[model samples]
Target: MKRLKTLASAVVAGTLALALAACGGNGATTETTDEGSSTAEAATGSTYKIGVLQLTEHAALDASNEGFVAALDDAGIDYEIDQQNAQNDQSACQTIASKLVNDGDDLILTIGTPAAQAVASATSDIPIIGTAITDFAESGLVADNEAPGGNVTGSSDLTPVADQIDLLQQLVPDAKTVGLLYCTAESNSEVQIAMAEEALDEAGIAHERYTVSSSNEIQQVVESMVGKVDAVYAPTDNTIAAGMATVSMVANENDLPVIVGCDTMVEDGGLASYSINYYDLGYKAGEMAVEILTEGADPAEMPIEYLAAEDCQLIANQATADEVGIDISGLEDAEIV
Candidate 1:
């Protein structure tokens, strides 16, 4: 009877152990299923959201956004674009960036320096790409120009300032003193100014720096430099670019030749400009974004790139040139639009 009781007790213990083992196995299987389900949800092919924070409404920046969207569409990436224009307001830009981060955007595209800086401060995980920025280093995006060892990488719209100075020399050979006019707050303007100053030093040309902090002060500063310098050089500064009409009027009235950092300024009545096509730079940025999205590439690993454009065109406005009493007949290949 005692032996029977012992056997029964052994059987009961063995059954309970089996039951516990079964429960453990079931729990493991369920946990694995839940994890798999979570992963599946994470990998689900859903629409990606991209936030574009543009500083202002300008032709170049607008074109950049257009190019970026076109490239994403070409890649068949279903994405929703949320565009916000800061209108050159830094605080507004910060708000827009914060909202985009809080809203969980997969990527962020910044058009200008302030916008880029705002986005960088807002999030570290979301990939940020910038276009139309002159110098990434000057803009505080990276430590140096060679490698942007961070979460930001994009194209720079840096016009070759040395070549531009050489072009100016070709256009006005007798020009001894050149006036450099730009906005002090714009880092892009500073980058161009630094390059121009160095090139002028190399060329043995004397230059006067006239910087204005806003568009309202442009006309006065430029007017002051009119007769003091033989020629003027204006960079791709948003403030000055927006107020080109005033600069052109003053320059034409004083019969002073003006060389600009961008072809768009040339179109706006400046004498000549040599710079990369803004649209091409935008397209390159778009390409970089695609690489990051598709190839699992990190923005930090991508090197900052500059668009290569050859042959600076001598764009002479006939009316402006005639007004300035400057005549050049040697070059038929020059664009006189």
Candidate 2:
């Protein structure tokens, strides 16, 4: 078995206690839930339950959640979506994941790596669909990306980190040193950060690392990077994205252009981004989930999908460009948002 995440495994035992308590209060079991789903399929088809455990609230993640629901709606898949947000807390993901499992959801859609890990540890029998995750294999949510070989599978939101860094250089030509701001608690952030560093180093640019363990320290941590770096590069991180307003305020006020990994961050007040569409990413995941439910598709054979490179848009915050004194008029290819 793959090693469960430290925080997620720490709460797995407690999840069991809740699991036991749930059985005494209800007449349902996992087997019965499946039988009921079959019976519902023969009748009104409204008994299907889907658990949505989101890591946090951010425009990108929210768009993904919306896209997921939209897909189910368009497909006429009537399901009782139990939406749950962990509020960027790993422990909370563990608890919610356990509850979803104990509640015997037909499937679980985890919006981030932490939520995915928590649910993956909670139950291997229930199909888990993950989105907004950088790497399923790297995060240990699956045995392989191309072939999941297990119950977990979904689209990977591995943004073009290297290309984003290159665009950062083009956007901030005078930027000699860049500050990499991210949350250490987010594994996906670390992956993007490392890729960003490598891309920056290849271009012979100096960079610094600025990490915050939680959202409470975001403003302070971002504030500390003012004079130290010429620009800030924040990856598609849940904690940092949730606190983007503070980040933009600190960096934009200082005339430090922030190049982010998600387009939603640019809309949230960053300078620019070359990122994938989270809505499309989640919609694809929803289709995969639909195939699993309707066609009896096996998650094990499903390869992780991703948006095409052409789908990544070059987005710039026009208001931020005006504030940062960078004339983006020359970059006509970028869509000014």
Candidate 3:
């Protein structure tokens, strides 16, 4: 009878061991999907595969990517990171997203709205974190902002749009018609454009909209409207940001001051911008990622993050101001770049 009891105890211990192995020893569970893809919960203390997809190669986006990686490094998490840039091409972003998903990344970080949307569409099983997106709902990435209610959540680069419009008015107070330049393809840009329109209309400022389909058309579009409007207002549009050289060239030639949405564009030649720090936004996103991956927090319940009001800065480019013959000296409290 004693021998029989010992055998039964051994059998029970073996079953318990199997159950623990199935749980991955860290409350993680794995299963194979119908598509033959393996999906598993993140297990702490194990090396994780992280994939980063950036929409373009602009300074703001680059700073965002840098901050994300820096935060990850600071967290001391063991992760294999694969970073890729789409060069402002949507198709390239799609391909990169698929490759990253197929690579079986534990998590994916997207820099812009396009990249985020691509990755979100590629795989619903993988967690996605996006930064530099203005409105997740407007971008169709999330159904609600307070609670993501889906597998997507991240930081927003939603600078104070109305305040930016007000700053543009302050810079060019005598301006009657402010030319609104942006790309129609980006929904993020569209959200900003609508806000700018409402703000401009509220100020009784007449505005003209100039649309660009791609980077190649920016110069011609800006040239056509340079002399027609008193000043140009560009929201945080990635296509226009990438082609700021041409936009600034046309604006400078016509002595038309340009008010942009971010400091990076100001540095690229726009006269001024009231914006949030993209790097800070990215760093915040990274911290959220660590919580989700290491702490096993669900991203679906994570609230969308934003840069604090204190972190927003006013950036003015002295060279651009001087070239455009705008006197920014009277502007008090602005950070001269």
Candidate 4:
């Protein structure tokens, strides 16, 4: 009986030793599999998310947004876009900025100055790209116009103020005084106003400023400037652009002609406008954003670029010009859309 028990114990020990050796070999194989899985994951890069914040819904702003998206599509990158419209509300703009920051976006594209300011205030880490902004210096996004030394770099939609003044003079040769209409709250409008004032001085033309805080004040402002100035110049102010119809109605009724900073304004019934295409500016901004994402370019390093095209179209409302008894002779050479 002792000899049979000894043989069974020997067999059990051998089986235990073989099982331990098998587990040791499997453990090494498992570690190698894990390392291979990690390598594969590192090779397949993760997708990125982009947030776009626009101040208001207007033709020009909408076109900018469209151009931005189109550029992104042209670059075949895996990206998601979260778009928010502030509806011309500053407070809403702040809220949208906060929400986008919290949502973990890789980059944020702000359409207008107000939206850019809100996004810049919201996050310092996330890259901020601005478009359709007139003056980065005036918007407080940068220290100077030439070098925007910060995390924010973008495209400027600034119309040449001196050229605009000259265009107005060409259209209205006999005009002695011009009235500048804009929004006081907007830094962009303020910048344009300053430039316009300087240009008017250089042209030897007398000019006055008519500033409004909101759309509600436009009628009163226009009425006040009617008999005071010969012609009115409206910059690309958001408030004025949104309430252009009212300004046009009041100006047309008062037999006044208005020269605007954008072509869309002319389409909305203004007498004429000379400005860059907003969509092209936005598309350029999108190209910059992609560079920041894929090429690993620093936003600060990318200087704020202006649209290359200085081409401005002279869109005239023939009916309105005729009604006001204003003669536009060289309009045939101008690109009338």
TM-score of each: 0.83, 0.86, 0.86, 0.84
Write model 3 residue lDDT over 211-315, tens digit each, in one string.
988888999899899668999899888888888988998898789999998999999899988778888888999999988887788888998887765577888
lDDT of 4 by residue, 1-337 (tens): 0011121222122211110000000000000000111222245564667888888877888888888877776776666788888877777777888989999888999988888988898988899999988767656786654566777988888776556677778778888999999887777777677777776888899998898887889999999997899999998888888888898889988889888888788778788766678888889999998888877888777777776433445566665676566776675555454
- lDDT of every model, 2 decimals: 0.72, 0.79, 0.78, 0.74
RMSD of candidate 4 to the truth, in angstroms, is 25.5
Clashing pairs in 2: none
lDDT of the structure predicted as candidate 4? 0.74
The reply for model 1, stretches above 4 Å from the true place, is 1-44, 311-314
> Which digits, one per residue and each the tens of the lDDT, describe model 1 over residues 51-117?
8887776566777777776676566655667878777766777778898899898888888877888
Best candidate, lDDT-wise?
Answer: 2
Model 2, position 132: C-alpha lDDT score:
89
**TM-score quality measure for candidate 3:** 0.86
Model 2, residue 67: C-alpha shift (Å): 0.6
Query: Could you give the candidate ranking by lDDT, starting with the highest?
Result: 2, 3, 4, 1
> For candidate 3, what is the total of clashing residue pairs?
0
